[model samples]
Target: MEGSKKGYQFTAGQERFRNLIPRYYANSHVAIGVFDISNKASFTSLEFWIQELKRYAPSDCKIILIGNKADLKEKRQVLPKDKLPWTSESKHPKIIEISAKTLKKPNSILDSIASEGLAVKKARTLKQEEEERENERIQMYGEHSETPPMRRRKFLMCGSDRGQRK
Candidate 1:
C-alpha cells in the first residue's frame, strides 16, 4: 500500500497535522501548545509552535501550554506544571498538565483560557478605542506590576470597568 510505504518513514509534516492548524484552527480563539510528557524527543517542538504563532500572529494572541500524556507517571520525561520559559519571564505562558488517559484537569486549563479570551477581546476593544485618540499609545504588557507616576487613564473605559468591578 502507498500509505503503508510512507508509514515506515514518519516525519513532522505528516498528513494528520498538515494543514490541520489553518483549516481547523483559523477561527479558533485559543491555541493550545501540547506535548507528550513521556517523550523527550518532543521537548523542543512545543517551543517551535509558540515561536511560529508569535511570528505570524498578533501581539496579544491567546495561548495555553499543555503537557499531555501524563497518565504514564513513570514515563513522564517532563513532570506536571513544568515551567517552559522560552520567552519574556515577566510575562509567561501558563503550563497545564493533562492526561488523555485519565482526563485530569483538562477543564481547568480550558476554563482559564476562556476567561483570558474574554479579557483579550475586551483588550482589543480598548485598543480600538485608544487608536481613535491619536495621542494614546496603550502599553500592552506588565501594566499591573508597576504603579504609574500619576493615574491618567482613570477615565478610560477599558480600565474603569475593572475598578468598578473591584
Candidate 2:
C-alpha cells in the first residue's frame, strides 16, 4: 500500500503463513487485524490474533482493527454496537469497516494505516538516535559526573600530587 509518498507491504497472518509471522513481526511497525463483519466466528477470532501479535510483535507496535464485508449489511453477524464492548476492553482503539468485494474506499484505509505505520517508524528511529547520542555522552563523561572521565582522572591525580607536596 502507498501512503502519500511512502509504500508499505502487507502480509497475511493466516494459519498457512504462521511460520513467517514471527519474522514479519520482528520488523513490523504496525499490525492490522482484519475480520469479516458478516461472520461472528471471524470477529471472535480477533482475540486470538491480537494475543499472537502481542506475543511476537514489538511492544511499541501499533495495532489497527478492520471489519470487512460492510457492504453485506443484511448478512452482517457482527454489528457496530456489538464490537464496542470488546474494542473498549481491548488494546484496539477503533475499528474500520470496509467492503473488499465492493472496493469501497479501500485506498483510504490503506493510506491511513501506511501513514500511521510510517509515523511510528519515524518516532522509533528518532528515539533510537537519541539513545545513541545519550550513550555516547555517558561514555565520554562519567554516568553521574558533569566532568569528562579524563578530566576527573586528572583531577584525582593532581589532588594526590598536591597532598604529597603539602
Candidate 3:
C-alpha cells in the first residue's frame, strides 16, 4: 500500500474463518479491524477480532479500527465517538470512518494506515532498544541497592515425633 510519502508492500490475505486467527496472525505488523457502521452486530463483533489480533499477532502489532460505510451515515448503527467495550488504554486502536464506495481518494486511507503502522513499528523498536540498554546497564552496574539485607532468624520447631518437652 502507498504510505504518506512512500509505498510499502504487504502480503495481505483474508481468512473467512474468524476462529482461526492464531493460525494466520503470526508475524503481522499491522492489522485492520473492519466493521460495518450500518450493522450493529458487525460493529459489536469487532471486539472479538481485536482480542484475537492482540492475542495471536506479534507484541508490537498495530491495529486500525475502521468503521466502514461512511456514505450510509443516515443508516449508521454505530456512532463514531461511541466508547468501545474492548479498547485498552495502553494500546488503543486508531478508529477511522471511511466509505470505499464513495471515496474519491482511497489512497488517503491507505496513507493513514501505512503512516500509523510505521509509527507504531518505530515506537516499538525504540522501546525495545531502550529496554536492552537498561538491561545492559543493570548487568554492568548491578541493580541499585535500596536497603540492606535482613539477617536470618532462628525458629524453634515443635514436632510430635520428637516428643517435644517444655
Candidate 4:
C-alpha cells in the first residue's frame, strides 16, 4: 500500500480483511478518514468510509476528514470548491487538507483530534461528577425527598411550609 500512486486499491483479498477494521472502531474516541486529493476514486470512497465509521464506532466518536497529497496540486482531483456530501450532517466533522510527504499543516489534523478528544473527556468527567453528586444527595436524603437536605432542615426550623400546609 505504501508509495502506491493509485492510493488505496482494495483487492478481493483485502475485502475480507476489512471486517477486522470495525473492531478497532468500537473503542475509538476519534476516527480520521484520509483520502488522496489527487485521486478522484479515493475522494469518492470517503463517503463509504464515513458510513462505516458511523456504523461501527461509538455514537459519540468524533470524525476528522483529511485530504492528503496537497503538494500534488497539479494532479488534484478533489478541489477545495467541491462540497462534501457529509457536510450537511448534524455532526459536521472537521475537514482538513494536508501533504504527508511535505508535512504540510499535518499538525492541524492532530490538533483537531486532540481538541475533540479532550472535549469528550471533559464532558464524560462532568457527567460522572453530576451522577456522583446525585447519588450522594440520594443517600443523605431519601430519593423521594421533595426538598434538598439543607432546605428541608431550614423549613423545619421555621415551622412553616411557606403556608402550604393548612
Best candidate according to lDDT: 2
Question: What does the lDDT read for residue 166 in candidate 1?
Answer: 39
Question: Candidate 2, residue 7: CA error in Å?
Answer: 6.9
* Per-residue lDDT of 51 in model 3: 79
Residue pairs with clashing backbones, model 3: none
Give the CA lDDT, 0 to 100, for residue 88 in model 2: 49
Higher-TM-score candidate among 3 and 4? Answer: 4
The 0-to-1 C-alpha lDDT of every candidate, in the order given, reads 0.62, 0.77, 0.72, 0.74
Give the per-residue lDDT of model 3 (tens digit) for 8-36.
Answer: 33323345565566766775667887788
TM-score per candidate? 0.60, 0.76, 0.62, 0.71
Q: Can you write out model 2's per-residue Cα lDDT over 1-166, one digit (the tens) per residue? A: 4343544446565577777778878867777888899899888877776777778988778888899999999998998877533444655545789988898988888777887788888899999999998888888775876768787788779737554643
- Better structure of 1 and 2 per lDDT: 2
Query: lDDT, candidate 1, residue 118?
Result: 65
Residue-wise C-alpha lDDT for candidate 1, range 1-166, written one tens digit per residue: 1121111111253557644544443433456666788886675567766776665556676777677887878988886545565877655677777888889886777567776666776788798787764333225323353434344455355435554643
lDDT of 4 by residue, 1-166 (tens): 2232221223222467687767767766677777889998887777777788778887787887788899999999998767667657566777689988999786666667777766665677798899998888788888987667898678687956675856
- The candidate 4 region of ten consecutive residues with least summed lDDT is 1-10
The TM-score leader among the candidates is 2
Worst 10 contiguous positions by lDDT, candidate 2: 1-10
TM-score of 4: 0.71
Clashing pairs in 2: none
